[model samples]
Target: MADTYKFRIDHHGSLIRPAEVLNARARHAAGELDDAGLRAVEDEAISESARQQRKLRMSVVTDGEFRREDFRGAVLDTVGGFRRTGGTDKYGRAQWVADGEVKAGGPLIADGYDGVKAMAGTAAPKAGLPSPAFLAATCFDREISGAAYKSPVELGEALARIIRDEIELLISRGIRLVQLNNFRYASYLFSRGGQPLTLDEAIAVDSIAVDLTAKPEDVRIGLCPTHQVTGTVDRDAATRLFAGLPVDRWVLPYDKGAEGEADLLRAVPADRDAALGIVDPATAELEDVETIMQRMDAAAELKDIENIAVSPSAGFADTAGRAAISADDQRRKLIHVETIARMCWGNEL
Candidate 1:
């Protein structure tokens, strides 16, 4: 396990401001702002986001994704060769989902350096990549078959190239810790009647991308299961699957009031440092520190205290127009993190 303490926030800004940003970009591109003017706005937004990170006192900050047009939809749109088809959401909203076979786009990097520079103002800024599951859910349909690519592997390799390019771009921009967000990893295990890859196969696929993009010391892999407290993340299985890989950190969902929380803690391997998600980022419900302390105490007995860090279960909740957390709530959360950090590194528990 790593000896030095570390912490991170879930990447959720895209979810927070997707509609507004996307629509704004569309309008800008449609002549609300000339090309030079639009670029200036993007630059300003990136700079402001970095300043905000410094104010938050976060060790690592993301670009706030102000440059992204859509959090989930843009990746699919960028990858060429997909046919758009009409689909209905569970709520019966008319939605368009990408289908049909497609050729992968060659490696393309984000054009904005202003955002990267802004995030690097004080704390280290790391670039983030969307997980394959998030990409696949939004873009790839199992029904689509391509003559150019016989399997998802062919397509995935192309996607991996683009991901690698993005990582390298971040490194070039002076960011060290690149986080790959793959929320769909475990969800595939429960897919009914789908040709999803097995656990070993999925690990292999992840390994390919990781190997291509990151040096052994420069990256951290962040995995999120689809649902909170799923009983499918086996520590021994993951240990075997990830053995000898240059993994620096591991993250998993730790939802409040979930039965799988205890099981998830038990499954975390003790050899690698872990981010124990205590707050749920998708909900507005504030966490009680006493409850979090109790959970951490239980988890500490399962995994070594030295191997843990405290953070929210995922990124901030996507609730629209939600009020920011109160200063007292923020202080309590920070106190919980500090207490955990002290216990882990200072042995002061």
Candidate 2:
């Protein structure tokens, strides 16, 4: 074991939970439980999730985003000018859609850190939100947003201010780590959903979104450049994205197709750290420590092992039932990550 390493499960922005919390949410919707009744259960659920993370011996613990449904929509819900379609998809999930003029809303992170921190105990408390880029790209309607702002860029700046305000809240509450999830950047690059901006445009907007000043080193900022670069990694685009980002830690998505992406290490800003995602989050496939070591070895070819951290390629419960893995599987995955951190970085075997 190398005895010193950094590991985070990734800010999934949601947590897999026991049936109690799930049932509470459903009942609250059905009017079977009052708001207080529902919130009590949510508190319990967040505490339990923190317990699980601590049990796994994680030095840093989060509330598992147990309070959010769609991480993206949750942030939008805090901002004014959007509504959830009363209609549900065939999947029955309530879709929060943007159909109104965007208005200045209340502080988005208000009381969020207080609650998550209250339950996390002595473990380092962490919290994250869906990125500002994801918010603007997915929620800002051209006709609707145009009515409220001079231009899309103006709306984007509004979002950056809101997010920075949220970061200030997190810092003030003594919360150390904050993550902004930005997988859509990768999705837009590879998938049919056109990216919200050109690569250069995105780099610019993203820099604004990520800009923050924490009072202390313990209050670190991180970002996840989601795992959507399909087939093979686009070295030029991906490198530019990483290099341009100013986060202290860069959470990169590299799972099944990561072999060709080893050069990603070469692109990581030397001043910024990396949490290399080596495990598959979309499948229940168990990665033996050897498999992780092989990926680590590949990364070592480009940068020293000390230069990187380790985690699941993504959060296990990012989209709620989307990853399709059992909760036990997530536990095992965390164990695998923690175990490998020890073997590879804790000390010599």
RMSD of each: 4.7, 3.6
User: Could you give candidate 2's per-residue lDDT for residues 189-211 as a string of tens digits?
Assistant: 44344665566665666678666
lDDT of 1 by residue, 215-243 (tens): 54534544444335555445555455435
Candidate 2 local lDDT, residue 74? 47
Best by TM-score: 2
The worst-scoring run of ten residues by lDDT in candidate 1 lies at 315-324
Q: Per model, how many backbone clashes are there?
A: 3, 9
Q: Candidates' TM-scores?
A: 0.75, 0.87
- lDDT, candidates in the order shown: 0.53, 0.66
